[model samples]
Target: MQQVKAVVARAKGQPVEVTTINVPDPGPGEAVVKIQACGVCHTDLHYREGGINADFPFLLGHEASGVVEAVGDDVTSVAPGDFVVLNWRAVCGQCRACERGEPQYCFATHNATQKMTLAEGDDAGTELSPALGIGAFAEKTLVAAGQCTKVDPSARPAAVGLLGCGVMAGIGAAINTGAVGRGRSVAVIGCGGVGVAAIAGSALAGASPIIAVDIDAGKLETAKALGATHTVDSSTTDPVEAIKEICAQTYAGAEGADVVIEAVGRPETWKQAFYARDLAGTVVLVGVPTPDMTVPELPLIDVFGRGGALKSSWYGDCLPSRDFPMLVDLYQQGRLDLDAFVTEEIGIDDVEAAFAKMHDGGVLRSVVIL
Candidate 1:
C-alpha cells in the first residue's frame, strides 16, 4: 500500500478536502500510475455538489496524464515507465457493444476492483468512490490497466491531460459523432472549453462559417482564437436566428447550419440547437444534463419532419485507444491547439479556488500539477 495526498469530497455540497489516502499495489488487471498532472473538470465540481450521485466522500478529479509505476501480472497493453493519459471508459472487448464492432459504446468498461480508502484521519477506513472511476487528483492513483492510453511523453502533461475528458468530448462530437465535413457550416452553442474545442474540431474538419454562440464576449473571443469564423453573444442576440442568418443557403432558403452542437445542457439551448440546423441537418448534444432536467414538450411530428439525426454524444462517443495518441500527435504537430485550454497550473490544494474560477467562468481549465 502507498499513502498519497488526494482531494476528497466527504459530503454532498461540501468543500473537497486534501487528505491522505491509501493506494494499493496493482492487482490482477490493475495498474498504479504516478500522476503527472490532472486537469480540473466540471464533473469533479458536480460530484462535490451532489449532482452526480449521493456517493459521499467521493475521490474527485479524473482528467489526468501520468507515468505508469506498476501493472498487473497479466497486463500487456501497458507496462511500467509508459507515459499515458488516463481514460474513464476502459473498453471490455467481450461486451455486446464490442461484439457489435462498436467498442466506443462498450457496455462493460473496466475499473480497478480494489478500493482506495482514507489512510489516517476521521474518515479512515472509509472507502471512497473515485470520480468517473479515475480519482486522479493525487500524487498517485490506481486504475484498470486498460484505462491507461500511452502517449508521447514529450507532450505537456497539463495541456494534453484535458483530452482525458472535455477536450476529447468536444473534438469527438464533431469528428466521430457529428461527422463534420469539408465546407459544412457548423454552429456550437456554449463557448466553454468543450464548445471551443468543438469549434477547433469543426475547423480541422474543413468546416466554413463556423459560428460560436455564448453569453460571454471573452469566451466568444477565445472561440475565435480557437477557430470560430463567427460568434454570437446569446445575451444580446437570438442565437438560433443568428445561426440561421450566418449559415443561410440562398438556393433552398435553408437558413440554418449543416450541423448544430448544443454544449450547454439546458432545455432552452437544446431547443435552439433543434431549430438552428438546416433541413435534414444533424444535432449533437454533448453537454451533460442534471437528472431533474427534462426536454421541453415539442411536437412529435416535428421530430419526424425535421428528418435528421438527433444524438446524445456520451463522452463524444470516443474510443480512447484510437483517439488519445492521434490527438497527442496533432498537438505535437501544432495542428490542435491543446495548450490554449490550460488557463493556469496550480497545486492540488488550489482545487477549491479552481472550482470557484470555474463557477465564475474565469478559466478554461486550472490544472493541478503535482
Candidate 2:
C-alpha cells in the first residue's frame, strides 16, 4: 500500500479531514487513477449524514476525471497515462441485465479488491468505504479498470467530471428515456445541475420550445443559458399552471407538456410531473429521493388512464464505455459547454463548505482540483 493524502469523513455530519491514507496498487481487473478533479455531489453529503448507509469513516467524493497511473494484469481497455472519467458501473457482462443485452442496467458492477486505509487513532485503520465505489477526494484512488472511461485530455477535468454523474443523468433523461425529439415541447422541473443538462440535451436532440421550471430565478437564467426556451419560477407561481401556460403556446390542444421531466424527487414535484404530461407523453425521474419518500397515493384506474410510461433513469442510461469518449470529443469540439458547469475550483478541504452551498443551489458544480 502506498501512503497518500485523502479527505476522510470520520463521523456523521462532521467535517472531512485531509489525512494520510494507504492506497494499494491495482490487482487483476483494477487500475490506479491519479485524480485531477472531483465534483462535490449531494450523495456524498448524504453518505456523511448517515442517510445512505451506516458505513463509518466514509471516503467521500465520486464524480471525477483523472489519468490512469497503472493497470493490473490482463487489462486491455485503457493504459497508463490515459485521461478518463470515472464511472461506478463497471459492467461484469455476466449479469442478467447484460445477458438481456441491457449492459446499461448491468446487475454486477465491480470495484477495487483492495481497500484504502488510514492511521486514525492508536491503530492503523483499513477498509475505508469509498463513495459510489470511487473515493476521488484523494490524490489517487483504485477502481475497476472498466470504470476508467478514456476521454479527451484537452477538456478540463473539473468540467468533464460533472458529466460522469448529474449532467449525464439529465441528458440521458431527455435523449434516452424520454425520447425527446425534434419539435417536441419538453418541460423540466428543478433547474439544477441535472435539469439544465436535460434542457441542453433536448436542444441538442432538436427539441423545440423547451420549458424550464424552478423555484430560483438564478437557476432559471442558468437554464436559459443551457438552452431552455421558456422559464417558470415555481416559488411565486404554481409550477403546474405555469408549465401548462408555456406548453399551450407550442403544443396546441394538449393539456400539458409533450415530455415532462421531474428532476426533483419530492412527492409534490412528482405529482406535478404525473399531472403535467400530454396524453401518451413520457415522464422521466432523474432525481433521487430518500427511501422514506413515497409517491402520492392514487387509484389504480388513474395509472392506466395516464396512457404513457413513467420511467426512472439511472446514470442517464449511459454505458460508460459507449458514452464517455464520444461526449469528451463533443466537449473538445466546443459543441458541449462543459466549461459552464464549473462554477468554482476548490480544494479537498472545502468539501464540507461546498455541501452547505448545495442546499441553496448556489453553484452548478463545485469541482475539487486535487
- The number of the candidate with the highest TM-score is 1
lDDT of 2 at 167: 85
Top candidate when judged by lDDT against the true structure: 1
Q: Where in model 1 is the C-alpha error above 4 Å?
A: 249-252
Candidate 1 global TM-score: 0.98
Task: Tell me how many clashing residue pairs each candidate has.
Answer: 0, 0
Candidate 2 per-residue C-alpha lDDT over 259-337 given as tens digits, one digit per residue, 9 for 90 to 100: 8889988888988887888878788999888899998986788778878889998889989888877777887888888
User: How does each model score on TM-score?
Assistant: 0.98, 0.97
Q: What is the clash tally of candidate 1?
A: 0
